[model samples]
Target: MQEILRKGLEEMIMKEALKKVLPLVGSVAMLAACGNGGNKANKEAGKTDHNGVAKFNMKVEHEGKPIKGGELRYALVSDDPIKGLFNPALCQDQSDQDVVNFMFDDIFIVDSNNHLTNDGLAKYKVDKDARTVTVTFPKGAKWSDGQPLTVDDYIFTHEFIANKDYPGVRYPSSVGPLVGAEEYHSGKAANISGIEKKDDQTVVLHYKQMNPSIEISGGDLLSYVIPKHVYENIPMNKVMSHDASRKNVVGNGPFKIESLIPGESVTLVANENFYKGRPKVDKITIDVVSSKNIISEMKNGNYDIAGMPADQYDAYKDAANFSVIGKPAYSYSYIGFKLGKWSNEKGANVMDPNAKMNNKKLRQAMAYALDNDQIAKKFYKGTRFSANSLIPPVFKEYNKDTPEYNYNPKKAKKLLDEAGYKDKDGDGFREDPNGKPLVIKYATMAGGQNDQTLALAYVQFWEKIGLKVELTTGRPIEFQAFYDKVEHDDPEIDVYSAAWGTGTDPDPSGLYGEHEKFNMTRYVSDEHTALLKDISSDKSFDEAHRKAAFDKWQNFAHEEAFAIPTLYRTGITAVNKRVKYYDLVSGSEDTKARLYNLQLTQSKPVGE
Candidate 1:
């Protein structure tokens, strides 16, 4: 639960959004064969050779018996300071979410395969016949502040999110299936009729229908509940800025926040009142480490654990003192084309049939112009793979039969030629069908030098196919500014490159739905809408039917090319040999529970 919840509830689209901060590092390092400490983590070794890819171990099996009561130092990689929005409901940045995970735990248990079970803090029973799920919180669970975890706290979370004055990015769509969530969100209903509290420990959720995604942690079926006693009186809009949301935040997880220097670092100690037994480690300290210095810092034994950036994996792959763990990340980077604008009045996307990028052939041609395969091999050293579909490979069941987009410059030129984009002005670049200059304004986020190089490489790929793709403001925009322009449907951006940490659930509707703000492309169509419905409809309860719908959407989305999948990444973490009993294989659900058994073999990490 800590893994997925560490990022957020499923389907909150982000700018690849620091989905752990390991993906943003730049600079190249030397490569070596999969080494001892790293290879021992996996039962089967990953193939490795010059110009070939090697897979790291998924878990660290350190030697020696564990000793108790040692501090675990963690590195938070980022270029900017964390915003310290500790509340999950209001926090949008994944970097901040990583910090909050130590003190918070999701209600559902996510298994190794990312499926949610009812074995965590809260237990629930889904009544298909009645279209409801009744949740029961064990009476003994208490927040760090010693307040009892109750049904009122659970209900207050939903009420706060649904309040008309709430100022967070989490939409009430997860609860839209509820009886009166729409009315509550629109300020029509005083309370959600679907969320009924039967007792102090139980709340019954009345839904219009049930879908398979509910078991996969979708639709916010079971999530962490904030202490109602602490946050009930705060104005909904001002909740994030209030003291309770920041320095005074409270949660029912295994750890409690001790102190924090906003945007710098945080110190945490074991939570004696945690529903689970106390954590084995005495204390934990997490510090914000710039991506530029993290690898060197790790070499100097300044940290016990840190996420390894894919581009820098080669440099750190041979570290003798640390074991590297790798896994298929629940995220992907994408290039989205602008085809329409979001309509607040209609509460849906309004397609611009005449939009510059609305042409299917044009979109396809642009997608073909991207040599993502070469980019992955050259820039990411095969740690990142060219994405074939929006539903990443992490979702094996649904990702299997999707369309593939490979590099084909000739095919790209042919598509453009057929679309009537020709160089009538005798310039190297092609002109639009209307014979006007075809200058595509591209918006992308700024990052390290290698990031700039990768961005420019994409532009060069477009240039080779005779498309004029220029950065939005002469260069990649800063993170916040880039999203601001894209979210507002800035006309200057015809296309943009960004990423999404596709949470634990495999549903893409939240990111692509007509009414979703995360649908930055603003594309809307009956065929697309129907396919999305098919994937999440009541009929999707049949696994085969749901998978088939997913396949159809993948094919349809690929053909539409409104948002072209760019790269599916591999997430790797380096842990000091001194740290014992740590594994990334367990999905987010097992994050906190693992800490209870975690120990240190030595007081100081290796290389100290």
Candidate 2:
């Protein structure tokens, strides 16, 4: 162990030496590939190659042994002030999603590698020809309130999302293949005709079209299985605000809500009657801590498990009894250009003719002007690498040769000139195509000091090429309001800075599709729709065919430049040596950080 630690230390020292001795281009190359940060308590490990791409071994660690009855305290990062109630169906942010996972089962268990398994349902089977999935539940399965989890619960879930008056959208996409879900949500039907309750224990879901995503899509179904008994009495539209969602929430998962204090903390105790058997941990306490304070909290022992900020990896990566786990995060973050007006209450973007950002070449020029290598080194501290496309390099479908905008201010200036946006006036900044002074509104979530610094870095990059930008929100906007502006498409928000963690499969449709609520840019085209459909919902059985389709779409999207893919990063979490049986992942679901199976102990069998 001592020898391994020495070698790791030597690597970091050499990396730093290489950076100073090398020129600007060579320094960026060294930063990308020089860390052993993403290992499981150093039991087994991962490696980064010359180009800075991280390769994860993903060997399962710390399991099959548990010391029961201990509270695991965790920390979270939120841009919002954190006062909203928890509703699984309506959850809009990471904090809500993390806590909601304990209050509800994710319906299916997705592993670190995107391999999904049946968790909430007793039996799950699919028929490709029928484009249908049949689901069943065990008789012993009961809600936290002791109500039997029946077909009515599942059916009600579909109905709830389909209810037009219900706030916070999560469906129609999950139910994309469901025969009548869109019709019901659009108020064209009374009920979802595709959902069939064969008996109290069995249900069959009929797909309106071909869908290869039925296996992992069970989570959407799981979101709907709210205790029908607990919610039946309440109005559908008002259910999201009910105490059943937060204060008095009841779930059939391994944990039960013990106490609730919004924005402060939440404590959950193990459920003895959990159908999968009670979890090893007796309790789990989630504390809402500022991202800036997470590193301090971890060092002070206030955070037993916390997302390790990249800038602080060196402080704890080789610390005694601590493991900094890293892996290809399942998500991507970007700077989105508002090509259309988010003109409706449902967060629809109506493409506007008069919109200044309708010029694709200008958006492309901004993409070209970014100093991504600097951000990766200074902002990410070698944990994240620059991304050319929204498709994460972690996925099999990611096309490495996709068109790139690799930090060329010269090319950016040329593009701006070619696009007819030149500095006709004596002022340093360029003007609109019609020669009017141009000021772009750049919106971002309100965050701590680090966030402010990062935002400035972005502004400086655009300013270099004569582009003028102003911060959209006066101050750091709270989390909920920030998304409300982005999603609902406030006209004031032209180019917004944001990040999205991708999901299990390398499917981008859910974010870029015409109907997706999370499509903040509101980017859509007939070609984009057809390509997305071919990958997931209306996909072909041929793997090669789907790969080609994905590759085509990624290249096209890159050229279009609706959003600039900023960084594809690996999430690092500092787990105290005492905390075992957990890992960090990114993507469609929160599988990497599964807390239920987590145990607190010092000893474990071989190969754990």
Q: Highest TM-score: give the candidate number.
A: 1
- The 10 consecutive residues of candidate 2 with the worst lDDT sum are 18-27
Q: Write the per-residue lDDT of candidate 2 for residues 206-310, one digit (tens) a residue.
A: 887765545543323333366778776888667777777768887766678888677788888887777767777788787777656665666666656655555
lDDT of 1 at 219: 51
Model 1 deviation from native, Cα RMSD in Å:
6.8
Q: CA lDDT, every prediction?
A: 0.74, 0.64
List model 1 lDDT by residue over 465-539, tens digit each.
899989889887777677779888999999988887777677787788887767889988899999988887888
